[model samples]
Target: MKVMVIVRATKSSEAGEMPSEQLLTEMGNFNEELSKAGIFLAAEGLHPSSNGARIRFSGKDRTVTDGPFTETKELIAGFWLWKVSSMQEAIDWVTRCPNPMTEDSDIEIRQVFEFDDFGEALTPELREQEERVQTEVAERNNNAQGIPASKDEDEIRSLAKAWSGSLESKDVDAMLTGYSEDILLYDVKPPYRLKGLEAYRANWEACLPYFPAKMKSEHRDFTVTVDGDVAFAHGLHHVVPIDEESPVGQTWLRITIGYQRTEGEWRVMHEHVSVPFDPMTEKVSYITDEVIAETI
Candidate 1:
């Protein structure tokens, strides 16, 4: 079970007062303990409502009110996410926590709503989208030394195939259309990193002559892992050369791609390719493992 612990400080508590240095140190130590226990998923402390605002709607009219309002009893100052085996376990942990505010303060612990708890009212698509967003957010937070999020594998795989197909077809115009105006690309080959539509097109044009020449290259073992709006894949290029003696020899190559969702559609953001070496001649080879892995 996952639960949210909201810490609310009364206006009187925060009035002309700040968190003491010793209290700050204690809070840091408490957070470290939570991390070590592996039960802490996320946490944050917010600024006082005195610096916030509220928006309200009455019929057709909307109103915005500045903070420092009189309702101190209803304001929240911070929150923490905890994952435990049961509600009682969470309660036990909370019972052990030191008071977050001076004098007497109240902390509210509420269980997070799980998808299954919604009964049959939640559509699969909506759930999937929610999961994707959560996963992406979690990945980013984890990368930034924060709590983790979830990821979806199927959607990412489908998106990868679509992207690769666009490339193999040389649908340059359509493919480039997917990218943002300020897009950035990273690849293992020439033009190391490219930015903008013009530069990307130039790089593609320079490399067009190296395609399969007969059968188009296919993206194989295309497994995509998506977190929120970002996704990535481990894929392979399967192609037979038109000329036998070409320097870029071999019928297969390894590729990894990273993508970001733009304007509600997935687009390639970064790509990496590696041509392994042949032990016999110490030369680069393209007979990648993805084909073999797929077969297995």
Candidate 2:
């Protein structure tokens, strides 16, 4: 859960009073603790209300009011966005925070609403739009901070497609970029599983030459799901030899990929590719009209 801890303004805060050096040091130490615990997302103090203004709306009419108005308790002076297990955890952290003002102050903790909270009201289309908006906001923030923007689901999907395309083109470097240094791959071939990027790349090097010089590959029924820094995608891939004389072609290899965001880049952390086999004969089954119908 995420919560915003708001520091309410006091008379001194509204008057533009700044915290003492000792208080600032104490607050900094507390912030360090929060960061170490991975609970802190963002925190900032606002300028005094004297430098702000508010607009009031009544139907179509609007009225503007200057700040440093009488209600000090109602004004916010600072806030911290935190991720915690529960409201109780938020409260416990808040209790340990240093006083943000020279005088006694009050801090309010409010839970942030998540997409799931909207339930059925958020249609698939709306959900996509929301994700786009979120990506835009994150990119803007990254630009302001001079950090590279992280890849979203669409970008990751493109990367996955490029990886598949590399197999046909035999572009080892491009294919290598799709995976992380610690990637784990479960391929259809022998050895059961391959660990690390070196092993995975070696496997590709040994197999690419066996494929046709002119090859065609397509990803079908692809689906990608992203949640925060982790994501996973699944699809069926069909590979065919472009040459009419070549008999080496396969259809519908089940593929699943897992990705993780590392330093603003999405890299494949895990991959699993397999073909169904008969239990009795231990023979791999290729896709066919009858097989598709049965599966459907």
Candidate 3:
């Protein structure tokens, strides 16, 4: 079972007080133990709420609120992601952890949801997407210490092609695998832009189902340019669906991807996808082969 061990914030933590060196050393030793036991997957401490903000939603309206939120006892100061054989095992591990704060602090352990936990909500396709995402995450972690020294345009283009293929498969995880952790995306949809792989993945999850089961994403006029560890590509991509009844039976979209060689792999750092719009009609012009040829 996977669990998240949450360290609840105390008055001192909310006041932006740092942990003492002795406590830090004790915690570091505990972390090392967790690592040796293979129970630790990830762990991190959070900055105080004073530096954070929250977006509250009601209907279609969103309200942004800055923080330095009250209720320090309810806030989380840090957390650890761990995998163990059972909940009891997780409990045992948490009990062994050092007190993370100078004041009275509490730790809450909750099980993390697995793909199988979703049951019927996760179709075979969705399950496959999840698996692909997991594989990509594993690969990224494995390559963390092996960053390549040279640029390879061909390899970069191949990586781009794989990402495009994932779009056709509606494999959100596979598509996201090509992007960096801090990927910036200017999408055709609302919200103007998206930052981070998690946001991009969520965007795909919400959009992919609208596409047909068997779709084909064809790339044309593809161009790739490389400069040292950085590369960029631009292309016209068309989405064709197997079912004629689908709302987007056939549509064209423009795509520009920025890649940076990181950890021996080409990962997308930025992506901008858009459709041209006519100012006169205030409507998008969905380009087709004829339109593309004429524009060229």
**TM-scores vs. true structure, each candidate:** 0.48, 0.51, 0.49
Candidate 3 residue-wise lDDT, 1-296, digit = tens: 67999999898888899988999999998887576444577999999999998899999999999998997888899999986656766776777788898877899999999988999999999999988887677667657867432237547755755665678768788887767999999998898999998998999899887888876555666777888788898877766665566767356788898988888888899989999999999998878767866986
**Candidate 3 runs further than 4 Å off:** 147-296
lDDT of predicted model 3: 0.80
- The number of clashing residue pairs in model 3 is 2
- Candidate 1: C-alpha lDDT: 0.68
* Candidate 1, backbone clash total: 4
Q: What tens-digit string does per-residue lDDT give for candidate 1 at 1-296?
A: 67999998666554736788988988887776565444577899877777889999999999999977677778888899986545655676687788888778888999999999997888898899998887777688777985343334534544444444566566677567555566676655666678877887888888767765543334545556767788777756654344455544354567787778877776777666766767899876546455465766
Better of 1 and 3 by TM-score: 3
How do the residues 196-221 of candidate 2 rate in per-residue lDDT, one tens digit apiece?
98998899899887878876555656
lDDT for each of the candidates? 0.68, 0.82, 0.80
Superposed on all Cα atoms, model 2 deviates from the true structure by an RMSD in Å of 20.2
Ranking by TM-score: 2, 3, 1
Using lDDT as the measure, the top candidate is: 2
How many clashes show up per model? 4, 0, 2
RMSD of each: 18.8, 20.2, 23.6
The deviation in Å at residue 150 for candidate 3 is 23
Clashes in model 2: which pairs? none
lDDT of 2 at 235: 72
